[model samples]
Target: MTKRQSRWAKALALCLLASVASGCALPRSGPSKSEIYSGSVLEDGDAFVVSVNDRVTRATSVTPVLGFSSEFLNAGEVGSDTIRPGDTLGLTVWENVDDGLLSSAGQAATALEEVQVDGSGFIFVPYAGRIRAAGNTPERLRQIITEKLDAQTPDPQVIVTRLAGDGATVSVMGGIASQGVYPIERPTRRLSAMLAEAGGVTVTPEIAQITVMRGSHQSKVWFQDLFADPRLDIALRGGDRILVEEDTRSFSVLGATGSQNRIRFETQTLSAIEAIAQVGGLNSNLADPTGVFVFRNEPESIARAVLGRNDLVGDQRMVYVLDLTEPNGMFEARDFAIRDDDTLYVTQAPFVRWQKTLSAVTGSLTPFANYSQLAGN
Candidate 1:
């Protein structure tokens, strides 16, 4: 090669070497292990980078607790067939006398198919006057009418049939298959049955929440728990408002993993290992098994337990490290619980930085090599 060509190649190669040697400028998914730890409070950084262990696992393994209180669970169940105000009754009245009070001229019976019980709880009949039908079952209402008409019309018989009405109905809304008013019938008196009639929940059962609002009282329970634990299936009430919500709790996965996304909780609670698996595990080519990390804001109580000290107050920023290369690493990761909004990041292996540096060096030398080859010709 000519002197000028040789001098050009040497200058370019030196500049490339200098730039590659400065690994800090290399493209990476996130900060390296040392870089992340450099930001911790122990190193005058923003977070406490604690190594994963049995104590850390217990200190961080917290899942959301959701359920109904005693008042809600112990509330009495109303019979689905019970009568209530604003109900419409289908009544059939019969009389043995030739000239009946309610029957037409040649008819022994009269049909009152749509006898509505007024808001005041009374239904009106020609011979029976006004009688309280609310708070009484169809059979009880029939008996009440029979006694009232018996005094005027001899041997009077009465039949009352309950019909679908605004009374004793619940309004189901939110993330449900069918959103509307559902009657509290014999088949749907409790929360679970009513949810089924509403075409079930539209979201994942583990994260779906069922909320019931009755008058001044309200209660909530995990949708899956409703059937898992029968006690959560509280009775339905008239004018009750039920809401079914979608799975909203999620955690973000970043750094050297298969993909970076906010993953929704598949179950009520999840372990760090499970969460990592959900995001397609670590990036095999670049992930550093020795530098797995979890970033979260732990509550005061949890911070105290994790640090083994009571001096810390309020929520504290925590950065947890998981080294899968250790003997008990996998077990520790499996035991470490993942909470909502936690960040899972796997640092790129140190060799990855060196690889990036090598790649840069090779790329920068390609033109020099081509120039020298052409100059030799």
Candidate 2:
């Protein structure tokens, strides 16, 4: 070959090499194709595999770690409603066919008189002066008053009834149609009953995110679960507060998915398979069937169980891959629970990367080839 032709050949080879290297070094939009499909490329403390059989067990085990307080699991049975400090008591005294201070001539009973329980939990009757009334059942208070007045009148009988007590009420706030304080009228009033009394949940509020605040402690449960499981419908206590709000739990879809966006769960629990369906499934034309990945920051306890170690970095951040090409992958996805704020990614196929690289090289070399042909002429 001539000197000019040899130099041109060398220049063309250098240009081609540079073009290929630059294409390979280009910044990726998301996780690399190899990282998604190859297990060897995954780093230590990077990813974990959840098989079909272990999916249910692993999901159920980690669910409590996602902010479910055990205190709300079992509902305590409510006992008889007791009197509070500000409760008014309707007192009635009776004497058997006798005209006394508490009764009239031939009258069986005296007129019902109202007595309010004082701040010190004491109420005064005509003969039974200043008796402890707060925290006692109405029947128990009646017996105490009757015993105290027995000697004053012949066969003296007493009856006590609660007249009004705003202090014995619970507050239902947040996303309810009618938010207010409701009086606990019955001994067996429960959470569901109180929600109904407050005009039910609002239209915009998420039914799956209901919270109950009792003093300093708070617990959360789905409205559907509260209704489905009678045990979760705990009995209401005085000063208890209920809050209904929008669901904040969500997951994001990125890369080669049908729609790349964040999706909120409609129910308390959602499986990985359901999440895929929610975002319109994978992009079949560009996605690799074996490259479905769920990126999450798993709890350290769970990471220890799955990875058999606790020394992982960055809060056990892991990428869990699912191979839809395998028959069992769909079944495993159905059982794998998707937690809040997780990321679901579907990576492109390996061939797609090569095709893109070759296309860039061909485009770059076309100009060089035209220059060489024109110079030769």
Candidate 3:
């Protein structure tokens, strides 16, 4: 070979060796042993690592913090409105004899009159004086009045009806189309019926986010499930407030995925596989099939149960790795539930890093090699 050709060949050989060395030095595709067990260390905190099977088992075993059964939701049922303070009672008294205290000599029965229950829950009656009206139902108040007037009037009869009561209404607000206070006119007025009376939820109702707040306790049920399951269409109570709001539960995708953003759950429940699909799945060219990970902050109770470690670190955070290269991994992903605010990360494949390094070296040398070729010609 000529001197010029030999020199060119040596230069090419040096470039190839440098590229190979750089490629070899690139980080491996899979996580290191430390990273697999303890997770990639962050500036603020360390991520705890767990296997996919362990994560699935832990997730399946976890009891939901927020859930309501038909029976539990029905427990707040206000079957009938009981008289309460601020209620106006329509009372009528009758006696066989004309000249009774409630009725004049010319009339046998007294006309119905409105009597307001005071703040102390007592209503004034002509003969019965101040009577307790708050805790009693309308029927019970009628009986109480008849017994109290029995001594003064002969064969006295009494009728008690609630004209207006504050406790007889339920408020429907939030994402509903028509927000208002609906009256519970009947004994069997259910939650679903009240929501319907308020013109139903607004456009694109997030059924999974419906909440019923009664007194100090609150319960939640999916709007669609409330309609589909008759049992969940629980009877509503007086003073109950129903709120329909957008679904706030979300998970985030990061690293080598197609996109990195927080995705809200469209349904009541979302699985890990579905969450991945929401972010456009993993990047085929860059993602490492064996290095998919999910990071979560677990409740202390669940963390203790799953890890069996008394160490507080186990309770604070957990990292779950999924090997999508395996066929069963896809199945397991479908079954695994993803909770709110979880982080899903797909690491870059080792080969991808090596390829990028080699490509960079070759690209940098191309102009130099071209100049050498021209000079030789």
Identify the runs in model 2 with alpha carbons over 4 angstroms from their true place.
1-28, 35-61, 65-81, 91-115, 125-128, 139-160, 203-207, 308-315, 362-377
Query: Which order, best to worst by TM-score?
Result: 1, 2, 3
Winner by TM-score? 1
lDDT of 1 by residue, 1-377 (tens): 88888898889888887877776557877888988989989888778889999988877878878888887788788886678898888999988988888888889999998888899888888867888888988898888889998899998988899988658899999999999998888888899899899998898776798888888887788898987898998877889999998768899999999999999898888999999999899999999999999999999999999998989988999999999999999999999999989999999999888888889888879977997998799
Give the poorly placed runs of model 3, Cα more than 4 Å off.
Answer: 1-48, 54-65, 68-81, 92-114, 125-128, 139-159, 203-207, 224-236, 299-316, 366-377
lDDT score at residue 172, model 2, on the 0-100 scale: 86
lDDT of 2 by residue, 1-377 (tens): 45687588668767776767555644345766564444432444335544334643374344422233556555464444588877777887888756786777788788566688888889878776889988898899988988888877777877788876654778888888899888877733788888888888874433346788888999887776776677778877778888888777789988787899989777666887889888888777778878787878777676666666667655665667777778788877887888888898888877777777667667676776777777777
| Cand. 1 TM to true fold | 0.88
Best by lDDT: 1
lDDT of each: 0.88, 0.73, 0.74
Give one digit per residue, the lDDT tens place, for model 3 in 4-73. Answer: 7668767876877585655454444444333455444443446656667745565444423445655556
Better of 1 and 2 by TM-score: 1
Residue 98 lDDT in candidate 2: 63
For candidate 1, the per-residue lDDT at 236 reads: 75
